[model samples]
Target: MAKAEFDTPQLKGIPVIPHLQPGAMAHSRPFVAKAEHQEPLGFPGELVDDWKTKAIDKMGELLTKYRALPVFLDACVKCGACTDKCHYYLGTADPKNMPVARQDLLRKVYRRYFTFAGKHFPKLVGAVELSEEVIEDWYRYYHQCSECRRCSVYCPYGIDTAEITMAGREILAHIGIGQKYSNEIIGKVHKIGNNLGLPRPALEDTLEGLEEEVEEDLGVKIRYPVDEKGADVLLVTPSADFFAEPHVDGLIGYGKVFHQAGISWTLSSYASEAANFGIFIGNYENMQKVAMRIRQAALDLGVKRIVVGECGHAWRVAYSFWNTLIGPFDFLDPKYPVPQHVCEFTYDLLQKGALKLDKAANDDKVVTFHDSCNVSRGSRMGDFPGGQFVIPREIIKASCNHYVDMAAETIHENTFCCGGGGGLLTDDLTELRVKGAVPRMEALKRVIDEDGVTHMAAICAICKSQFTKVLPFFGMGMDMIISVHQLVGDALVLGAEH
Candidate 1:
């Protein structure tokens, strides 16, 4: 229960190999889910009497179901190719934070139960039996991984540690060992339809408030519609956008873009949240349940297109998984991609010169774009391979006078996670979150010092929320992190300008 004392290290603008500290973050663990959270997600209410056996059985089930799990466990030759790839390793210098080391936490357990060498001569193959101590180690270290897959990009055999991390969490959850933050949020979404648990009345009231604010500022009554049947588009954004700073600003920007495009769009209180935390906990049934809300909303609303707001993992689920999770979309119009990113929608408008944008509107500030991990590597945008990286920057450039990127190594597909991803954004992991952000902070610092960048814009709500909190720890202003569409809203010219 004692908090680990983490001495904040100074960044030298170069990666430094830290002394291996085995138990540095052993105490960093998330809250356990209660019966309410666990039962609703189809997990046991509490740790079963034979949890060790059940956990091992769950691991066996996962290995049989997912070939990647078995292949990754057997394939790693300890070549150290991925030793230096993880941001957590770079930040904390904990050897267990290294991707391969993290994978071994579960791999060792797999070997003991399944592999002959591991079962007979366990010490030689680095295998260990499934015991209470090993289970506790799983709880501590697996939560440290953000599932960013940055390490996989460097591995010669394309060994994805994210797969191992997901398997580890899934097995833990099966034995009544769920993380409270993610399970509780999933419960809320199941009950109230979004992560924040904002009710339909509150959602409508907030949209109305936004309508009045836009009318006051722009002198135009731009609509933030909710559940309006027969609309042209149904906007499914993260619930954080309804209340959180910079996220709310991006929501306002979406309203402005839709207003300018002269399209009829409504937000469904039924599917208000785009974020599917089910992906974080590696629960496919829950992920599908979360995703089905959107399909139902689209059906009920009779919307022609589905446009998602500024959220990272939500886009991945929508872009990559939705079709498989709840799709074929035969009931809706076929004009668009079935579901489209708000950035792609706005960028398409820019390409067609549909909206009147005054780039000088953002003249007072110099901006940089942060490529969110899920969007950058897990999914793609536009028609090309790297469009996820290109499109966001293009939008910033078109909407602002000055835009600079962070270090070439730090941006695009090689981007570091915002440190609060993969359900680790809760207050419980504050130390881990802050330490995990060291590399990103160093990268952002270089840009700030060199380019006079006043703000960094992100498309992910978690990124915005994480940066707003962690940036201050690095002596940067909390307000330095802005939403991408916050810039778009600023630079957009309304009322017959086109």
Candidate 2:
């Protein structure tokens, strides 16, 4: 294989977030507010009283069932083995951070409402009656932690807090308390086929602009084709990648690699977003819709392979859940079968000696890779060809000379979340977001201050966005964050050499 040509697009301004730009020159609209209507899926104003009542009853019913799940019941041993492992508890010294305590917020109710001991003799199991105050407490504490799986690593039973968190969100969504930021984005993906809701016209315009930029910057003519028939790969990514800082640069890198490799790939204006927020809400139907867009795009394009972009949850949904949710497409080419992650794609190229890499490209940068919770721990689908999340380390180590670990407690399965996992990456929740992120930010600060690690490489858009915000709060600067693909781009010895 050969090096792919890259199309460099002129980035006009950072998307959505104006504060990301420097000085007084940058202008961004206020973050979109929460849902205004009471409709379970729409604005609160359109919600009729009866509809609201039904939605409330439905939510209560779902919460009632989830509270009685076998995993929730049989998993806890009350061993207190998972105590010291919590990131938030370690950081804030809050007793609520303990895995047992966190689950007890729901589990206590579970025992009370459903268990044999509670029904027969309430006081025996420490089971209490559920009330409005109990619901309020669940709402508060479940949202307090970032749903990072640090505790699961130490849990003897592997009772994941993230699972509990998702369950809580489902209960919330049932009750109509779902956040507009993510829920609306999911709705947008369904309505317009992309989360940012960019239509085909704007998408075509962005691609054309990228083509022209490639010609200007790299003296290469690269094509970002949409709806092209019989392409080899259909590239799926988070919509934020199109306009966000550092992420768009990864797109440029993707174009470069594919162009150099002489691969036939196209971006789809339809099903453009890789994010599947339906997973957050536990709405299997919506999850299928999101994944179906990709499969439909692939089938329609006649592509042999689908290459997922760097977004973590997108890949989590695609690689982990797509096969089960919206699959059995035996028509796809069996040789290079199924959707492949960009990391897997690039890593294979390097492994096969197809693309030349300039190891010296990242030579003096002390970089660390953040294993996103969704991609690493949350994934039940097992690893890509190379390994689970370790491929990132292999790729990073291959490209950069100085690689350092961020304390033993926060790597691989034990890694701390960027505090923005699970659809909470909105700007409106700044204070709570920052507080929940205290553990990870403090760990990063320690590594930056002690180990002299300058840059952090993360694959998820949420992680990137969250770090871009929280890193500054800890008095760090912006240049420290980069996508894993950006590092790959720097290392790739392009056909049109730098």
lDDT of 2 by residue, 1-498 (tens): 012221221222211111111111111111322554224344343223454344435544655565534575556878877766664454334566566777887676667665787767877776766565655555555655566667777777777776776666555555545656667778778778998989999998998887888678767786777778888888998887788877877787787778777889998988898888877656666678777888888888888888888887787788778899888768677765466788888777777777777778888688987788777776632244426566777778887788887766667777777767776676654544554556566667777777799999888888888888877766678668888877877777777342
User: How well does each candidate superpose onto the true structure, as a TM-score?
Assistant: 0.98, 0.84
Among these predictions, the greatest TM-score belongs to 1
lDDT of each: 0.90, 0.69
The list of candidate 1 runs beyond 4 A from truth reads 2-6
Over 1-498, each residue of candidate 1 has an lDDT whose tens digit, in order, gives 425566666767765667788877878898889999999999999999999889988988988898998888998888998888777888887889999999999999999999999999999998998989988988888899998888888887889888888888998999999999999999999988999899999999999998999899878899999999999999999999988897999999999999988889999999989999999998889999999999999999998899999999999899999999998888777877768999999999999889888999999999998899999889989988999998989999999999999987788988999999999998888888888888888898888888899999999999999998888887889998898998998899887565
Query: What are the C-alpha RMSDs, in order, of all predicted structures?
Result: 1.2, 9.5
